[model samples]
Target: MIEARQLTKRYGDKVAVDGVDFTVRPGAVTGFLGPNGAGKSTTMRMIIGLDAPTAGTVTVNGRRYAQHSAPLREVGALLEARSIHPGRSAFDHLMALAYTHGISRARVSEVIEMTGLQSVARKRAGAFSLGMGQRLGIAAAVLGDPQTVMLDEPVNGLDPEGVLWIRNLLTGLAAEGRTVFVSSHLMSEMALVADHLIIVGRGRVLADTTVRDLVLQAGGDTVVVATDDPAELRRVLVGPGVEITGHPGSEQLTVTGLPAREIGRKAAEHGLVLFELTAKTVSLEEAFMELTKESVEYHAASTTGRAA
Candidate 1:
């Protein structure tokens, strides 16, 4: 398991990571998510001892990452996929890492095959493509058979097949009771694979909850109403704690602060002709956008042409 308490990091006068706290338990996959410049990478770096925390503590399997006698055996991480020496072959690189930790040549071969790098095992590391580099990084990560696995953007350069493979690999690791923590900007993939989430915004913990709960919480009151007469329906539904949105002449209305059944009842009582009424369940992407809208570091301007 991975745990952090009041973990903080600062660079000069800027705070990179705030007093963050979250736990990644074994037998589950936890996704780390945030917008650009939200301190996600910085937080991950501190977890693996890449950077020192200004305050608080973080532990991997009950101890700091550097304190472990065989760090690889305790935690396997793919922080940077391209952090290998250019002069070394894939096999040579794995062998070097194995030698330091007393890992065997057989294990090295096994990982090479596991990551589907057998054909290019003897190829120079610098010549490999981004997808191949990702595979090599993963092979090195699991080479020690560690109890915890952490990866940052493992699918950055992967194709469709590779992305699918990673999804299965993450779930498989967690199935074996390993603590699997991954950081990704892909919300759709995270929604499918992650059992829980640790979301950050501007270096602070914005949410720490399960996938289902987050979506439900964000979508609880949202309802879609289709009616023949939207104007009259809107007038009837307008009240305290209610929000309605739609084009003036549109037949559909997006309503919040009211339940679907309540709207149906009110419509029926008013004898309004209704076409459809749906309690909209917000998707993972929608929930994420709503939660992080205010925390987004950059905003793109409208593409609509302005008057010259």
Candidate 2:
């Protein structure tokens, strides 16, 4: 488990991370999401003790990262894939890390094979592709076999197969009762992988909830109905706190805050047939955009002085 309580950070006059509180439980994948310059990286850095928080604190399991007796064994993080020395071979790099912890070469080999880096373990880090570098970083993170794993943008540039591999790897790690916390700007990938989400914006925590709850909060389970007898439907739907709007051209009426079953029953009672009555679900990307639209800091004003 990971707990960030009112974690705050500032650089001169600019505040990178405001007072933000969040919790990441074990046995599930928690996604940390935000736009560019949204302080997500800063927060993650603070969690791993890479950056000092100006106020508050972050803890893994029961203690702060620096307070842990064996930090590597408690938490493993892949913050940036390019943190490795460019000239060092992948195998040599892992060996160096193992030497610090008195870990065996067999353990190093296990991580290399686990991350599928066996083929290029002897290759220099500088010559590896972005995808390969990412895999190597993940290999190093998991080398200690930590109970909590945190990765920032784990799949920045990778082939489809590589992406799929990482997805399964993280799922497997979480299934093993390890806490997996990932941060990414990829909404679609997060939707497919994360069981819970922590949405941040402008150096503050905007939302910390399950993926299901976030989607439900977007107020999306509305059914769209199209019919030739929109007037009759409108008249029947009028009053009683029901909203009916014209659906651009045709005699279609869009009813809001109504269930599909009730709409069907009411239509039948009114002797009206619905040409199209289907429930429209909002995608994760769409829901994210709608929820974060007002929180976006930078925007280009259109000709009407509104955001473009």
Candidate 3:
């Protein structure tokens, strides 16, 4: 597990991350998300000991990363794929990273094959495409068989096939009981793979919970009912906590604070003929947008700026 207590970071007079506390547990893919300047990279850097925290403590498996005798065996990270040497082959790049942790040549070849880089394993790193470069980076990360895997935008340059591969790979890793903390901008893919989420806005956590729970919190289900006798149905559906809205001249009535079943049962009891009664739950993307809209640090000005 990864834990942070009152984690904070500062640069000159600017504060990138505030005193926020959160945990990334094992056995699930926990997505780390935030706006562009939300201190995600800064926090990840601090986690891996690449940058010293301005204050507070962060630990992996109950010990600081720097204290681990073999950090790579404990955790694998792929923060930047383009850091590899352009002069080396994909195989050579993995080999070099493997040698750092005293890994064997067999292990290097194994990861190369695991990430589907075998076909281009002998190709120079400079010649590989963006997707291939991402694959090589992943191979280097898993070369040591680390217990925890942290990837920042692992699917940034991946094609559809590559994206699907990473999704399955991360889920498989979590199923094997490894800690997987990933960050991605693709909400659709994140919704598909992540079991838990850590959403940050302006460097502070907005949510730390399961995906299902977050969606439920977004809002109650909206029930849409279309009836020939709209006025009669609306009169019967009126009650405390139930809010009904109409679109001016439209026949559809959107009701909140009641489930579809309840609405249908009420309609049947009142002998009202309904054309449609559907419950619509809020989506993850919508929830994220709502939560971050207020916390967004920058906003594009409206069309036609006022006189300077």
User: lDDT: which candidate is best?
Assistant: 1
For every model in order, what is the number of clashing pairs? 0, 0, 0
| C-alpha TM-scores of all predictions | 0.84, 0.86, 0.88
Q: What 10-residue stretch in candidate 1 is worst by lDDT?
A: 212-221
lDDT at residue 87 of model 3 (Cα atoms): 88
C-alpha lDDT of all candidate models, in order: 0.94, 0.88, 0.89
TM-score ranking, best first: 3, 2, 1
Model 3, residue 80: C-alpha shift (Å)? 0.5
Candidate 1 vs 3: which has more TM-score? 3
Model 1 shows how many backbone clashes? 0
What would you estimate as the lDDT of candidate 2? Answer: 0.88
Worst 10 residues of 3 by lDDT: 212-221
Candidate 3 lDDT by residue in tens digits, 189-282: 8899999999998878889988777776787468899998888888999999888999767889999878899999999999998899888878
* Tens-digit lDDT track of model 1 for 229-288: 999999999999899999977899999888899999999999998898999878899999
Which is better, 1 or 2, measured by TM-score?
Answer: 2
Q: Candidate 1's C-alpha lDDT?
A: 0.94
